[model samples]
Target: MAIEAQAPPPSATGPAVWLRKHFFATWYDTVFSLVFAVLIYLALKAFIGWAFVDAIWRVENKDLCTHDAGACWAVIESRGRLILFGLYPYEEQWRSTLACLAVIITIALSCLPSFWSIRRLPILWIAGFATFVLLMRGGFAGLELVTSEQWGGLSLTIFIFSAVFVIGMPLAVLFALARRSSLPVIAKSFGFFIDIVRSLPLLALLFAAAVVVPLLVPDWLQGNKLMRVVIAFAIFFAAYQAEIIRAGLQSISQGQEEAVAALGMPYWSLVIDILLPQAFRNTLPSTINQAVITFKETSIVTIIGFFEVMASGNAAIGSGEWGNQYVEVYVFLALIYFVFVFGLSRYGAWLETRMRLGHA
Candidate 1:
């Protein structure tokens, strides 16, 4: 009898072989693949030539920029300061820079595994937020006072993002737990509250907080417009995040809870020690998704009289001299947004990896 032949392992296949197997196995597949490849190459080449080969980078040579080709990067160099620190007094701009750096450092530090403990995390956050508030709204230590109204640009944007996440995350966990309560009344009421908030548009919620609430509330009850808006944004974030968390809880096997109960663990221990940790791990991607959405939505505060990064970018180009450079200003602003969002995504990935290693 002839010996049986063995197939080669899949890892032996190279990129060319993989592509041929997936996209050129049939005649129609081969034609579609070729057409898509040509279109992608043409588009990529055009973008590279326009953005790099013909782009202007110096403020001195700005006048030479023409309509026919190239990105106008010179506009960014000329108006970068204004975009970064909108309406802030030129002399006090350094304070804004330091304050923004402090917040960034705070965010980065909090993402580290060492600071995840309840006690350490709160202390770290409080100290960080205190420093930010003191530097931005300075009245102590003889530093010049800057009102929230005067806060704009990247600093304001950072403040809002930080405030929303810090406040919203805890609230979301509470809402999720409450909605899953064993008591019918408590669960139903909590669910209704979350649904009501989720049904409203974020803009409308923001507008109500910034404008309508002040009119109805007593003088002593009302806080600063910025604080009110932050609270409203936090509420909105909590509602959506609660649903994600509850879904994670539902994905968990009932046997896990039953096993914990059989081991004589209290309800709090069972939930906190077993359920929440697993739920959060399972829902980490959705949590990160919500955070990214929250960060971008901070730009919407510009519509409610707050001057965040987007509004600042508009002010950078609204000037008579650089009005034609709006595209460059927006591009610069986009890079700033990308940096923060990208960092957040990377941190989330790191957390997921750590969790898989049982180090979370």
Candidate 2:
């Protein structure tokens, strides 16, 4: 007791201290960290060298990139128009550009908290979609009318994805409600219908919509292959989304509904005012995941002869001039998809954080 006091251990804080504790805390961790650090450095060095230092960036210098070890980004520089607009008339491609911008702006607006209300959301989307269609179709004002067949590339992909989601969400709510109805017959019937749709492959459903539906439906009812396929895609999306909503509904307490009923609230009012909102909040993550999947699945329309963005990329690389640069085209296409998908993921995370804070 009469000796000296020992110094306190050094605090394991700050950047260097924290890094040492986390990455080199033990022998195995230190070894693993060193190994991975070497691998990452090598990868980054090679990627930077190939993608920037040696890459071809100019359209006129594309020939120099042929058979070279570096990336051929010049293909993108040259064929960007073809990749973006596809078969849309060259002069009228301006309309396609406007339509694409409209949809993109609509999507961006929808992500904002201020536009989260049901009334505001619907009005925003409807006006945005209407503007998109009017500009693309161009039957009004002094613009020429372009049919659905003429629509392709990124604009077509966005249109199909948005149409499917907008149409499917309401149908999914109906299906979920029907499946949970008190009436035995209605519940059983909807359950069976959902089963039937869910059991079939999406490809088969689209094929039937594109090829078989016209034979059975009336002339005016058939509309166009694009419409028919969109309806079918919506149904497919609804079948899965319905189950998600139903699960959300089931997660709600029986007492919550009973309490609302005891207050003399009408069934529709109780559902719309309390139950549906809570259910959607509970299932937001799953809903966002389904939306992402549906957006990616829009590419399947290409099989039925619709030239969406994926098909446009394929066509961009199919030519003799850029045939060897399929990798470049595909990489560009991946970047496009990553933009939308990553945005969706970040929006979902933001929604979850905001809702959690609200509940807290």
Candidate 3:
């Protein structure tokens, strides 16, 4: 019996084990895996051939691309500037470029952990956005003035998204707190307002802001149509975001608030130091989702004649020379959206990981 004792047979491991378990454990599994692998290989091969191997990359000889079985990247090479900067005066595009770079830098700075503090973030954004407006508008400091109407393309899209978020986030926090207030009248009033705004269509709200509000307000108070539209968009965003904040607020334990209150912390301190941080952390995913939605929805402003990036992309292909290259233009546009959206997704994932390693 002692002599018969032996070690167990060696087990499959590594990629071989993983493949056996996941892809080839059974006959049907093996068949399915082979079919899917073949499909993926074919798709990748087609994409690579069309996008790189056979594609036209140079700006010249674009007409030769018409008969080719590949993408016409030449259109993007030719019209990239127009698509990015829209109808801004070509001579003054340098200002628009600087303005966009400022906004981008501001965004990048905000994502850094050091800028996450409340005071630092507010100051950073104000300084960055102020610089953006000054450079873009430019009636002062000897720079050529460009009206908001002249603002278009990617810069306009980023401005609208940033402005909406900057204004709406504070409004959303206030709305959430007001809706949760002890005073019945205040809570009910805020709740009703939020519901009403959320019920209306966003496009209709933009239209009213751009059109009807002007007729109703005094001429002196009508303000710029772009400003009015932005305000309306912010208010709309706040309505939905408030509910997300409220859900986060409600998730907090009653004992947490009670403990903070028992410690003699001021109401403001309790909310700011204890409750709001937890609430925001709890709702980070929803908040990021809302932001991404808002970013995409900015394109809807084009319906009212604002030439954001999406509209600018369309304009790139609207010309006779690039008319047949719509696919290439749209692919370029998709990449633009992908860069921002994918960055947001990755940031959200990072935040989730960071928070999981923190206090519950």
Candidate 4:
């Protein structure tokens, strides 16, 4: 008697199959996963209890916090303005709000494919930055003058990051090209300069820009302290970004450059159309990482006495009235950072996807 061969089992799919494959592949895997799952559940439960179940929310009242075992979010409720706007006058904070919104809108628009052109991007950024400054400074159109010194908190942080990127990117491109110059002198000089800037600590650069530059420059030459710090930050950003762009440029095949050269395009056309675009495409991730870094580094301005968001957060909790609520204040600050940084990272990921699909 001949027996018929049995068919192989049907291929698995769905949630149960996925779970068993990944989390319960073996007895050890199942045990470890169960432990971690329980740990995560406990952590979430504790966070929910502290953040919502026992938290206080009423504004301008600290009395409720003295007896509370949960997070004293009342501190945030009371001092949210100080954290958001810092030393900016309470009455004029409406301007700061609009200014912050301007920068955010500009950034959002810049991320879109429609505004990615060199001409369009430059125009959009100019308008956006002008609006931010006009609203924050407010010297014209019957608005009261608020000097740069008075600019602080989130608006200042946004301005610093935007200005640094706007200024530094072009500067970085120029440095990258100069470092790759046909002449050894030009290449070596830019390379040396880039290395020197990269070698120095950012804090030291800011200190020299803030404290030492004043003694060296004439009174007429010493512009706003904020502007000086921004310039220094931009230079430091340029050095690193220059190297990133250079690496991108170097990654291109020599055959592509030769082909482009044979096409008899002007040098600028070759760079603007043929080379830089591909370079940026190659280094998109690194460029995005650099931008995120520059944004967070704005907090370093506080060390030089500029009250960006981190400094503002400190001010929120330093007033003794809400001193015990430091955790809540820091958490709140972290959430603000998380919003911007996460959004940036998501945007970067989107761009990468677009580029891969050739939609960029």
Candidates' RMSD to native: 2.7, 2.8, 2.8, 2.6
Ranking by TM-score: 4, 2, 3, 1
Q: How many clashing residue pairs are found in candidate 3?
A: 0
Give per-model TM-scores: 0.90, 0.95, 0.94, 0.96
Evaluation by TM-score, superior candidate among 1 and 3: 3
**Evaluation by lDDT, superior candidate among 1 and 2:** 2
lDDT of 4 by residue, 1-360 (tens): 999999999898999999999999999999999999999999999999999988888865456676557788888878899999999989999999999999999988988899889799999999999999899999888888998888888889888999999999999999999999999999999999999999999999999999999999999999989889999999999999999999999999999889888988788998998789889999999999999999889999998899899999998899868788899999999999999999999999988988988933
- Model 3 lDDT at residue 275: 87
Whichever of 2 and 3 has more lDDT, that candidate is 2
Best by TM-score: 4
Candidate 1 per-residue lDDT, tens place, 92-117, comes to 88989998888888898998888888
Predict model 4's lDDT versus the native: 0.92
Candidate 4: 10-residue stretch with minimal lDDT: 59-68
For all candidates in order, the CA lDDT equals 0.90, 0.92, 0.92, 0.92
Where is model 2 poorest over a 10-residue stretch in terms of lDDT?
60-69
Q: Write the per-residue lDDT of candidate 2 for residues 1-360, one digit (tens) a residue.
A: 697889999766789888988999899999999999999999999888888888999988876986766889999988888888888888999999999999999989988989988799999999999999999999878898899898999999999999999899999999999999999999999999999999999999999999999899999889889989999999999999999999999999999999998999999998898889889889999999999999999999988999899999998998988898888788889999999999998999999999889878
lDDT of 3 by residue, 1-360 (tens): 368878998786899888799999999999999999999999999999999888989887676787565998999889998888888878888888898999889988998888989799999999989998898899987988889998988999999999999899999999999999999999999999999999999999999999899889999998898999999999999999999999999999999999987999999998898989899999999999999999999999988889899999999999988899998899999999999988988998898888878865
